[model samples]
Target: MIQVKQLTKRFGQTVAVKNVSFSVEKGQILGFLGPNGAGKTTTMRILTCYIPADEGSASIAGLDVFENSLEVREKIGYLPENAPLYPDMGVIDYLNFIAEMREITGLERKKRLREMIDICGLEKALSKQIGQLSKGYRQRVGLAQTLIHHPDVLILDEPTTGLDPNQIMEIRQLIKEVGKEKTVILCSHILPEVEVTCQRVIIINEGEIVASGTPEELTNKALGGQTIFIKIKGPKGEIDSKLNNLPGLVSFRKSSEEGHNFYRYEIKGDGHREHCEDLFRMAVDNNWILSELRMEGASLEDVFRQLTAKEK
Candidate 1:
């Protein structure tokens, strides 16, 4: 659980974060998104108590982040954009060192280190030096370090930055696995990753909170965006009038393919799921053959662009 109210940060006259607020429920993977310099990293640093906010307040679980930074640290596992690694230390050895730092000791530390190594698929690189690990393995090692503490919350900033396509997918799967029972706030520029992994999203622009909701909720809240395609063998004007009978109906566009015509209807968001059956019945009554009908929902990328475009 996490909460922030009008959280902001500034450097001199430049505001790095401005009045941004959002919450993450337990076991929820929340996508934290924005363009470059939109305060994602800044906000994350504040939440993790790595940096203090200049104004407003943030709390994790039940304690103020600034007031209880140490307690908050106990509950969070943070992976910054550039995760540190001991170049010469062996992978397992480095992880063991971090384990000891986290106050894990004796058999407990050893067991967690083994589990983390297994979870991150680093068994083959157990004895390999950190510098010998490839970039992807290094990222996993960073993740392993974050999980070695067995934290309740994970704050990952650009977790999959330099990996290839397969590597990215691998990391995303790893994130999904780890997010099962842990609260996670993942900051990423890649739209698909968020769409795939996050149940809810918070979009920030120019340090202000622009949008926050489930992907579907935010997309549907965008008014004036109902478009349905109809494929039927009715005379053009007749098919057009039939659809126009609906409430809040707008103009319809007609296109032809072979002998059939497509009547594309643009209407208000009228919660009209039943319109499909009604339209089919009318088509049959008029002796018109029906072929295709479907609703086109807005893509997440489109929503993101529309929500953030005003910053320009």
Candidate 2:
């Protein structure tokens, strides 16, 4: 439902985004990840028509964001990192104002307001002033206003900022539910949140897209192979010999030494479960005690670091 091609933006001599390109399918939740000062917010602003790009093009549902800015805005709901809110207005009043601004009036306006209150879990805070509500509640109010117009696309930047663990989970669930029908572009610094909630991810660094893929695909690409952690009780020389001879073993390193007999080892090899089986068989053949053996796959955080880390 969204497409960007060769998009570039600059401020003075600084390039904020450079030839960045990606697409999001209808009803898909895409995670946009980057380190600080990576132009994430700048890109979002361009997509929302809040700012124009210096070069290239972006479109929402086939409407050019620059040429058809008004129409594009109609199809998009944007919740910026810091939600714009009036402190003195009551929660309900604030939402009602948003509804009116969206041209929703009378029965439809009241219905949408009630629905937002229910969907955002704002019933208890509706009568309270926005400034009196907790940060989490204020975030909910922001989300409610964004949804008040039922836009086809939701662009949320740091949607869970300032939220407690429980509130974060609640908002994640809500986003997932909303994503069942609407396309969503979520920007977050939390790797685990993006890993768990998004269908696909685009990682950007130095104003350029460094990687894009499913979580599992990116993880595998980052790791290059599987990592096996094993704790065994055996003679050090014998164990090393056996491990060295194991098929598909690319490298091995001693992680820790537990007493004189037990040792912890991390083995890297071709990503396959058979490697673990091979380790167990080798231990049994040598009459060595196998205390622990488990395969560890690369996490999203690993992929993030691999892609965004500064080159030596």
Full-model lDDT for every candidate: 0.83, 0.92
Model 2 steric clash total: 0
Residue 178, model 1: lDDT of 91
> What TM-score does candidate 1 reach?
0.90
Candidate 1 lDDT over 166-279, as tens digits, reads 999999999998999899999988888888889999988888988888877766655445556677776777766777785544445665455435444433444334555666
For every candidate structure, what is the RMSD over all alpha carbons to the true structure, in angstroms? 2.5, 2.4
Write model 2 residue lDDT over 36-110, tens digit each, in one string: 999898999999998999999999999999999999999999999899999999998899899988999999998
Return the TM-score for each candidate structure: 0.90, 0.90
Q: Which ranges in model 2 have alpha carbons more than 4 Å from their true place?
A: 223-225, 233-242, 245-248, 256-263, 270-274, 281-288
